[model samples]
Target: MADIEIFTGPNCGYCREAKRLLDAGGYAYREHDVSQPDAQALMRARLPRARSIPQIFVDGVHLGGSDDLAARLAQGPL
Candidate 1:
């Protein structure tokens, strides 16, 4: 399976939904809450122009936000 990492923030609905889908699929992932000050630089590095929360990465590839992740999931497994 591919490595999955999720960049999230506080009070993010899409982040919760992403987690739900991953959990349902039994996919393990690392979650980073960008709401924290320490994670700001890292989040910026991952998504330069990202203006929203729930940015997800699969094997180092930026898969975009929750809707994008759902679209990818619908297309089938990675």
Candidate 2:
């Protein structure tokens, strides 16, 4: 399995959906809640122009948000 990271904020619907997809796909991931101060700083460092929630990374590669992840999943397995 690949190392996965999900950067998200509280009350984000996309974040929840992303998590659900990962769970259903049987992929483990590290979730960083950007709503927290430390995680927020980390997310900003990673994505300077991230004006949205649920920024996802797969094996250190940026896979974008929930929609992006879903699209990737739709194409094939990661």
Candidate 3:
């Protein structure tokens, strides 16, 4: 089993969708709410270039945002 991480914000629809897709696919994930101070700091440290919510990772690899996930899902499993 691979480790999955997702950085999210409370009001972010894409973040919700990302989680939804993960649930639908039966992929377990650790979610960090970047809206929280500590989580925000950690997210910035890990993904300095991420400009939006729903920043996702699998086994420690950055995987962009929700649209990126959708495209990847289209291809196959994440």
Candidate 4:
């Protein structure tokens, strides 16, 4: 299985969509709520220039946001 991590904020639709796609693909992931200070700091450390929520990482590689995830999913397995 791949190591998947998602950084999300509260009530984010894109975050929901991203999780849904992962779920549908039977991909297990660790979710970090960026609303929390520690998680926010972690996310920033991983992606310094990210200006949005639902930033995803696969096996420590940045995969960008929800739309990018969708595009990646469309290509094949994560």
Candidate 5:
């Protein structure tokens, strides 16, 4: 299985959708809520240019946000 990590924020629809997609695909993932201080710092350290919630990492590869994740899922299996 791939190592999946998702950075999410409170009340984020995209974050929920991203998690749904992963769940539907039967992928196990670790979710980090940026609402917490530690997760926020970790997200900033990993993606300095990203200015959105629901940032996703697949096996250490940046997969952008929910839309990007959808596109990736459409292409094939992750």
Candidate 6:
């Protein structure tokens, strides 16, 4: 099992999808809502290349956005 971290924002379908996938897979993760104060800046500081919502990290390793996560899921279980 790996520690998962997912960055999210309000009303983002990608965010919902990411959470949904994690839920379906029974992956317990830390969720960071970028809509909160300083969250966006925190995300930027933590993930400089983050260009969108639902940026996922697996055990501190950058795994990218929702589509990236989906592709990874298609490859195999984490």
Query: What are the lDDT scores of the predictions, listed in order?
Result: 0.89, 0.93, 0.91, 0.94, 0.96, 0.89
Model 3: per-residue Cα lDDT over 1-78, one tens digit each:
668999999989999999999999999999999989999999999988777899999889998899999888899887
Worst 10 contiguous positions by lDDT, candidate 6: 35-44
- Model 6 global lDDT (CA atoms, 0 to 1): 0.89
Which one is best on lDDT?
A: 5
Candidate 3 has which clashing residue pairs, if any?
A: none
Window of ten residues with lowest summed lDDT in model 1: 32-41
TM-score, cand. 4: 0.95
**Which portions of model 4 miss their true places by more than 4 Å?**
none
Give the Cα RMSD of candidate 1. Answer: 0.9
Query: Evaluated with TM-score, which candidate comes out highest?
Result: 5
> Higher-lDDT candidate among 3 and 6?
3
| lDDT by residue (tens digit), candidate 4, 1-78 | 899999999999999999999999999999999999999999888888888989999999999999999999999998
Instruction: Locate the minimum summed-lDDT window of 10 residues in model 2.
Output: 6-15
lDDT of 6 by residue, 1-78 (tens): 889999999999999999999899988999989989777888999988768888899989989988998899889887
Error of 6 at 43 (Å): 0.6
lDDT of 5: 0.96
TM-score of 6: 0.90
Of candidates 6 and 5, the better by TM-score: 5
Flag clash pairs in model 1: none
Q: Please, what is the TM-score per model?
A: 0.93, 0.96, 0.93, 0.95, 0.96, 0.90
What does the lDDT come to for candidate 2?
0.93
RMSD of each: 0.9, 0.7, 0.9, 0.7, 0.6, 1.2
- 1-78 in candidate 2: lDDT tens per residue? 889999987888999999999999999999998879999999999999989989999999999999999999999889
Tell me the tens digit of each residue's lDDT in model 1 across 1-78. Answer: 989999988888999999998998889999998978767779998678988989899999999988998899999985
